[model samples]
Target: MNITLPGKAATLMASQRERAEKQRARLGVEARSWYRISNAASDDEAEVMIYDEVGGWFGCTADDMIAELRQITAPRMRVRINSPGGSVFEGIAIANALRAHPASVTVQVDAVAASIASVIAMAGDRIEMAPNSMLMIHDASGLCMGNAADMEEMAELLDLISDNIADAYAARAGGTREQWRERMRAETWYLPEDAVENGLADEAVQAPKAGNAPPAPEEDDEPDMARAWDLAAYGYQGPRRDEPKTEEQQPLTINIGAAVGEDFVEQLRALVRQEVKDRTVAPASDATPTGPVAETEPVEPAPEPAAVPEPEVPAAEPVDAWAADIAGLLTTPADDWAADLTHLIGPDTSSRAAAEA
Candidate 1:
């Protein structure tokens, strides 16, 4: 049945769809099969993948899926879904077919089951969702091309469809039809655990190991393809990929003594000492000249002066014995000065010398 949206909403959706079509065209994206069927672990078991939209836009229609299912003679069928949903009627038909199948049906939500796709999931005897997967429920919506009467009729039809869909949810999850309708109207999204807690899924399960998996199609090789769909156009604002995580860097450590030998360290210290001594001794070398230098006149010879008698030197003040000893020690060679000073003073002098060195 044709679904309907409000005038403004329908117009916006049409514009968005137009833009998406242009973008897909620019990207050279061609329509291809959105599902695959293959044998499972056992000969009597089969797996069906509905990994895109539900209808022909970028996926298979109900007739296509049902026909494929008819060919499987397995006693058990595993239906895996990862879709943003498509034609509501198509999805409902597929779901009904799965329910009518003689095989024990198991539904696995690989990533997402939104809109009509969630209805398709309800047909499973056992529904399992991947840990990071999601399920969404929303009121039926579509476009109608006509005047006020046609719009009104379309709106009424959409409400009926939505009510039926809500009833399907209520049947599975044990809620009142009206309660489910409220949630659908709000576009409820459920994470794996939430889906289980709300009875939408039986359990959240771990994905099968790669070793036990069947070879995937080349188109599905890129994991991001699931997240790459334009779910935004459907007003889905659920989880999505962010930037990839980078490996944490290890902390750095340095062993100075091991990196540079003791000899090298000593040499460095000696160079530092020499630098400090030079800076201390010639601090004025870095000063800027303040003014121009005056010209020097030639020195004139001084006239000889009469000699005067030298006054007798006053008796030298008696020097303290310790002062004499210190004076003598000051004359020692620079290499022995530390030792001499330590001898004159005490252990503290030796410590001071070592520290200065």
Candidate 2:
């Protein structure tokens, strides 16, 4: 039953109270006391709504819930809860009363079942959480102003209260008592899926009927501690992350070489050939001879030369070895010319090889 709390727990609770008061002032009411009961056409069935702070108001204890139930003799009942929990003792009392009631109880959370509210929800034979709803669990919170001995006693009392709360949660949830205690210590929050996964809720409620306007969401003045923790963990809106703005994102660009497919190669080659042809044709036209005729002189053609007789000559002697070698060298293939020159250089083989190397 022993528990350890953070050093700032007292400050956190005070801030929570202060914020809740602000919300009450803004809403122009205690922002609570939303409850109702309906007897269906069948006398043996009923539905009850618990849609605000638990434990009622001043001078109204847990007895209010019991009083409402006593008037209904229905054999089957539905309890709908959407509450920010108040008065853990009263919540526990209501839960116990529901547990003892002869009717089979089915609980549906329309919005949220948090803290002791979640404990009361566990009283149901079957529990359902709305797709958009949540459940939260944590150790009991309180304030104590006194001497060291008094403070020690209060701490011990808190631990005992926490253990009782854990017992309430562990009885219905998936995990063992110790594991639930650890989860409570961490101040866990559960989306509908999370609740189902952890056995806290039996199912997710179906979508509301068409043309039925959804209940307007309550203004959530999130407790500062919880707000800070959620922001650190799941961010502003639970698991969903805000998409990056267009201005925040870098523009995407594709590389031409990478993007061009094999089918484009022939088309690209044809384009290059057309460009080469245009360049070649433009310079050839510019290179055509251009001149102007004189104003006084007439255009004239050049005269052809007269024919002449061919001279007779005797045959010449054979060519010299050097001349013949020079002619042979000129006609030799470029690769063989180097070897021919090396041979013509009069066999200084070592020197030629050294030079070539």
Candidate 3:
């Protein structure tokens, strides 16, 4: 098959292939067995495990999976997957084979079913996810190593593959293909509950507990499984097993006008005015000047200026206009106001003169 891969995926494949080749150089044919099959002898059901990358130079190929699948005469099959997915064409081929099989196939997402592995998931007669498992879907992507024409062709091919994948999702989930396509473009990830809610899985089942299991498997005894895989290579960095799910918090809002009543505002203003008046009436400081103390005697206070005649009062304005004027006057800082009361009152010269004195 013609090989096309995402840049990082291709790099990973190359590294694994090199390691596999080296192992084969020393271990001979034993190193090439990349897939696992169990319970094939049972007539009722058989198990197939796809716990690694899909078709590649070193990993399990579609032909190998199909060849083994054909040998299983069981009427029911269980395909367990915990894969990061591999070649899109290979995944499609495997999905097709499972769909065409005479046995009823049930797919269990043991840990994760991401990328093209999710496509293979659609072939199941019934899909189930463990409570903490996840399934992800995204637009098909691959690297093109040729000229402009070749790049364009590759882009077109990717589009076609995405559409086909979308169809597969829609067929199982009962949504319009365009709706699924939009989600795929955004690279949607689904927890078990979300998968069931979206109709992608029949149900989320409890994880099976092994009888007589060891206290904990040794770290070096098994390869780094699901959680250890670098899913960031495919732009997925979401919740995983044994991690807490954080919920988004709503922003806090305060309504000052509602919290402070008009009566409180009036009381506050009165307090401020009394405070200002006390500060103004206090005697000036008796401390000597910082630069130099003048020896001259203090001059007598100048006689009070002759009282000016009050201006003629204008006719009363509209209530709104009067309110607006009062509001504008209130905006001035209390500290900026002069001690003169006449500027704020109607013809009350006696009170103003008394205040000035």
Per-residue lDDT over 82-133 for candidate 1, one digit per residue giving the tens place of the 0 to 100 score? 9898778778889999999999999999999999889999999999999799
Query: 287 in model 1: Cα distance from truth in Å?
Result: 98
- Per-residue lDDT of candidate 3, residues 113-226 (tens digit): 999899999999999998799999999887678677787777787888888889999999998989999999998999999999999999899866869776776877776567
Query: What shift in Å separates residue 176 of candidate 1 from its native position after superposition?
Result: 1.1
Estimate every model's Cα lDDT from 0 to 1: 0.76, 0.71, 0.75
Worst 10 residues of 2 by lDDT: 262-271
Question: Candidate 3 at residue 121, lDDT?
Answer: 92
lDDT of 2 by residue, 1-357 (tens): 112234555675455446655665676644554466787736887898888777544223466558878877899988999988876766888899889989989999989898888988999999999879999998887666667876887778787888888887778875677888899899999999989998899998777677978677666743557656566565455433476646546677554335654223223333333333554574435565569845787658788788787897555334556545544544434546444443433322356335633
Candidate 1 regions exceeding 4 Å error are 1-31, 206-357
At residue 116, candidate 2 shows an lDDT of: 82
Off by over 4 Å in 3: 1-29, 32-34, 40-43, 207-357
Task: Enumerate residue pairs that collide in model 3.
Answer: none
- TM-score of each prediction: 0.50, 0.49, 0.52
Estimate the TM-score for candidate 2: 0.49
Give each prediction's root-mean-square deviation over alpha carbons.
Answer: 24.8, 28.7, 28.8
Q: Tell me the lDDT of model 1 at 103.
A: 91
